[model samples]
Target chain A: MTTASRATRNATSRPGGRSARVRDQVLEAVQAELADTGYDGLTIDGVAARSGVHRTTIYRRWKTVAGLLVDLLEAGVDDTWAPADTGSLEADLVALNREVREALSGDSSVTLAVIAASFRTPEAAEALTRFWDDRYERSAVVVERAITRGEVPGDTAAARVVMAATSPLYHQLVLRRSRMSRAEADQYARDSAAAAIAGLLRH
Target chain B: MTTASRATRNATSRPGGRSARVRDQVLEAVQAELADTGYDGLTIDGVAARSGVHRTTIYRRWKTVAGLLVDLLEAGVDDTWAPADTGSLEADLVALNREVREALSGDSSVTLAVIAASFRTPEAAEALTRFWDDRYERSAVVVERAITRGEVPGDTAAARVVMAATSPLYHQLVLRRSRMSRAEADQYARDSAAAAIAGLLRH
Candidate 1:
């Protein structure tokens, strides 16, 4: 999986060319297939047919279905959906909520498939765990900034702060299967921010 | 699925007799098979052999793999793991969190299978949705009691309180694949309770 991921990360050597276009098209096809069939049922041949990319090319590049999915998962997580650094914690959290709402609510099947795949195999689980751990660590900076500004206690748990802000949206989207409108996201942001400010997130 | 669930619900007709024992053995076999093969690869015949129950009996009763899985899901959800009414919002939430943590953390594979099956079919999705909605509604009573005690506003959303209190456990267990400890659950309960008390859960 690491080798394949390295290949994908470096595959952009031909960025801005026909190769990049083909890569984007194939990744799009992969997402569509994931939404339709999930990880268990996904196949390289199916992706080839859907993307009009040759099977030989997909095989040569990705090497396996899990490899292809790892790449897709990485891309999904690396799409630059960063939390805002607004001067105020409340506004920053609201911006972060909106970004997450848009990212996840767009295609829930992808996340579900990743979850399914994660439990099915150790490699997949490691990949998914890394994706989230990285995201959480990166996003915890917002809480750190809040702490620096004295909006929250110095001992506040940054990861917990971020998790408090975002878990409800994930809960609604994945477990509850409910819609997360901007108003709902706003409510969550406000509530979680209030909780953080009150020192509820401190260890 | 409904008829099978009805049968399982009333399977105690021959309490302490062959009928009850058969039901237990069959459900145990279903969970074992679900854990081993997952819903995609599970089969009625496989469950029959594992349980040593006649295939005809299983088919006559459960009718489909999804039906059997649904019954197992219902029984899992219907277990006597109600949220505690400990006369305080914080204590009740802590009790609820412990119950949920114990239930879900007992067998990760079973929940993963339900999630996998849910995304595979509309019926499974409906069953999963119903399971969570029922659990949420049932557990919201703790927050309602808090309102009555004047610990929180009357307009505080009970479901939201419950969701806020419990979503982190689910998020960690299912999505993040992180280890959930008793301390973590306690922290979540306290933080969510504080948020509710601060009127963050209104509406």
Candidate 2:
């Protein structure tokens, strides 16, 4: 679950216990450090100081920088979006498009930094792959729902269709150094759904 | 012009010219250095030593690491492919796809390393932007040719069509850490053309 829900759960089950508080503080500190200093500049001592947590505790729980970042990314993957159960496939894909656009555009540089780091190291690569896999799996539900509603073919590759809708945005943001306007994102969504309807994403 | 054509021109016009030879060696050294030790580890001194050219000449001509790389990348942008005017839009887009796939898969890691570096530095960012713009311009011709041949609509965005055909391969290679076969490339081409023909790419 996302930190917001996790916090809610902590309040009900444990009433602001020390361990839950520590975890919240540490993760908050990590987010701040990632924003301020970026991935390369972050250090355990800095995080410990910022979080008011002990170095031993941080090291014992997270073995390396990659480990910490991986956990942070995993924590980020908790689903905050669901496919629009709208009557039409076009509208549902557009809803899915906006969800992805908002998520990436928030703290865009920080997200890009983590992605760039993934290219340089195997540990980071694995973590980033897992993060993307989680996203694709979540987005795939949208396609599956559309299929079940009889809006698309049963044998369509859900993730591939999702990738078709979103890859252009990612490409523009990361490599082309451009932002995807809402209009552009909507167009991409519509085009990708049209392609799926044309049976391009069939299994 | 690309290195090969530049070398050929130099040989015929000014045979065995020292300046042309020096230019060739310096760029060759840069490529080797980029492959052996990534962008961060490369140094002018190392390139100068490897190329057997004076440090002063290297500094005077290229000035900085980014300068050398930018020049090298620009040299790589010379036109080498033409859209197969095979009277079928499907054949033309497929041909364009193979060109991109070959260029990218040749030194995939090195290309990604440069792209990753772009996110961190302004100089690298400019070079990478130019590199992509050149590729897009070159490929846009394919779409334009198809339009002239009355294959696609006049209002279709040529570069966007090209981006559709190639962006997934880039996403898979760089972010998803996946390999793409020739079959996959061909499929992407066909799907993108199908989308365009359906009027999805029309402006």
Against the native complex, each candidate's DockQ, computed on alpha carbons, is 0.60, 0.61
Mark the 10 consecutive residues where model 2 chain A has the least summed lDDT. A1-10
TM-score (C-alpha) between model 1 and the true structure? 0.83
Q: Return the top candidate by lDDT.
A: 1
Q: Per-residue alpha-carbon lDDT of model 1 for A26-58, expressed as tens digits?
A: 777777787788777799999999999999999
Ten-residue stretch with the least lDDT total in model 2 chain B: B1-10
Tell me, by TM-score, which candidate is best.
Answer: 2
Off by over 4 Å in 2: A1-21, A77-87, A106-108, B1-20, B77-87, B106-109
Residue clash pairs of candidate 1: none
lDDT of 1 at B98: 82
Alpha-carbon lDDT of model 1: 0.75
Q: What lDDT does the true structure give each of the candidates? A: 0.75, 0.70
Candidate 2 per-residue C-alpha lDDT over A44-159 given as tens digits, one digit per residue, 9 for 90 to 100: 89889999999899999987777777766665554353456777767877877776566456453456656766756677777777777766776687788778888789998886
TM-score of 2: 0.84
